[model samples]
Target: MQFETCHIPGLVIVTPKVFSDSRGFFFEAYNRKPFEEAGITANFVQDNQSQSSYGVIRGLHFQRNPFAQSKLVRVLQGTILDVGVDIREGSPTFGQHFSIELSAENKKQLFLPAGFAHGFSVLSETAIVAYKCDNYYSKESEGGIRYDDPELAIDWKIDPAKAIVSGKDLELPLLSESFANFTY
Candidate 1:
C-alpha cells in the first residue's frame, strides 16, 4: 500500500497496490505493519457503512474531545467526492479542506485523523461508503459545520438545487459559529 499525507498533519491518502488478472483482482486494503510503517497507528474500534444516491451529501461532521474519531474511509460500490476539513485550532491549516475522488475502480482510501471534520457527496447513481473509526459514536459530542458555509467554499461537484441533505445537517452551524471551542 502507498500512503501520502495531505496538507493537514496526520491526514492521509492510501492507495493499494492491486494485483489484477483476467479473473479478478486483489489487494491488501489494510495491513497493520505496513500502515504503521507509513506512520498511521490509529487503533480502529468500529466499522461503519452507508449507501447514498447521486446528489446526496452528508458531512462536515465531527465529535468533540473525549469522543473524537479518526476515520479510514473508502468506496465500495460506486463513487463519491470525499472531503475532510482541518478544524484543529492553532494548526497552520485550520479551516482548510481537502477532497478526493474515491471509487470501487480506484480502490483508494482516505485517513481523516481526529481533529478534522468529514463528509462526502455521492457522484454515482448509487454509492456504498465504508469506513473504520478509532472511536465509537457519541451523540452528545456530535458537531458539524454547515456544508454551504461561504468561508469554507467547498465545491461538492453537484448542483445545489439537486443536493439532498438531512435535517440534522441543515441545522449545523456555520464555520465561524462552530469553531468557538476548537483546539488542536
Candidate 2:
C-alpha cells in the first residue's frame, strides 16, 4: 500500500496493493497496523454508506469540534469526484480544497482529517460511497457550506443547473456565512 499526503496537512490519498486472478481481484482496503505505521492512527468508530445517481451532489459538510470526524472515504461501485476543503481557521491552507477521482476501477481512498468539510459528485450512472468516521455524529454540531458557494466555486462537473440537490443542501449557507462553529 502507498500513502500520499495531499497539499493540505493531514489529508492523504491511499493506494492499496491489488491482486488479480482469472476470476477477479482482491485488496486489503483497510488494515490498522499498516495505517498506524503510515502515521494515521485514528480510531474510526462508525461506518457510513450512501448511494446516489449521476449529478447528485451530497455535501460540503462537517461537524464541529467535539463531534468532528476524520473520514476515510472510497467508492464501492462506480465513479465520483470526491472533494475536501480545509476549513481549519488560521491554518495556512484555510479555505483551500482538493479533489480526486475515486472509482471501483481504480480503488483509491481518501483520508480527510477532522478539520475538513467533505463532499462528492457522482460521475457514473450511479455510485456507492462508503466511509469510516473517527467520531460519532452530532445533530447540533452538523454544519455545511453551500455546494455552489460563489467564493468556494466548487465544480461538480455536471451542469449546476442540471444537478440534483436536496432542499436542505440547496439552502445550506455559503461558506462565508456558515460554520462559525468550526475551530482553529
Candidate 3:
C-alpha cells in the first residue's frame, strides 16, 4: 500500500497495490504494522457501513472533543465523491477540504484523522460505503457543518435541486458557527 499525505497534517490517502489475474484480484486493505510504521496508529474500535443512492449527500459531519473519531473509509460496491474538511482550529488549512473519487474499481481508501469533518455524495445508482473508526459513535457529540455553507463552497458534483439530504444535515450550522470550540 502507498500512503500520501493530504494538505492537513494527519490526513492521508491510501492506494493499495492490487494483484489481479483473469480470475480476480486481491489486496491488503489493512495491515496494522505498515500502517503503524506510516504514522497512523489509531486503535479502531468500530466499523460502520452505509448504502446510498445517486444524488444522496451525507455530510460535513464530525463528533466534538472527547468523541472525535479518526476513520479509514472506502467504497465497496459503486462510486462516490468523498470529502474531508479540516475543522481543527489554528491549523493552516482549517476550513479547507480534500475531495477524491472512491470506487470499487479503484480500491482506494482515505484516512481522515480526528479533528476533521467528513461527507460524501453518491455517484452511482447505489453505493456501499464502509469505514473503520477509532472511536465509537456518540449521539450527543455529533455535529456538522451545512453541506452548502457558502464559506466552504464545496462542489458536490451534483445539481442542488437533485441533491438529497437528511433533515439533520439540512439544519447543520455554517463552518464559522461550528468552529467556535474547535481545536487543532
Please rank every candidate by lDDT, starting with the best.
Answer: 1, 3, 2
Candidate 2 C-alpha lDDT tens digits along 1-184: 9999988888999999999999899999999999999999999999999999999999888998789999999999999999998888888988888999999999999999888999999999999999999999899999888898888878888887779999988888887787645555
Which candidate number maximizes lDDT? 1
Q: Write the per-residue lDDT of candidate 3 for residues 1-184, one digit (tens) a residue.
A: 8999976788899999999999999999998988998999999999999999999999989998788899999999999999999998888999998899999999999999888899999999999999999999999899999999998899999899999999989999999888535676
Q: What do the candidate models score in CA lDDT, each in turn?
A: 0.93, 0.91, 0.92
lDDT of 1 by residue, 65-184 (tens): 888999999999999999999998888999999999999999999999899899999999999999999999999889999999899999999999999999999999988899535676
Clashes of each: 0, 0, 0
Q: In model 1, what lDDT does residue 1 have?
A: 91
Badly placed stretches (over 4 Å) of model 1 are 179-182
Query: What TM-score do all the candidates reach, one by one?
Result: 0.97, 0.96, 0.97
Better-scoring candidate (lDDT), 1 or 3: 1
Looking at candidate 1, the ten consecutive residues that score lowest on lDDT are 175-184
Error of 3 at 15 (Å): 0.6
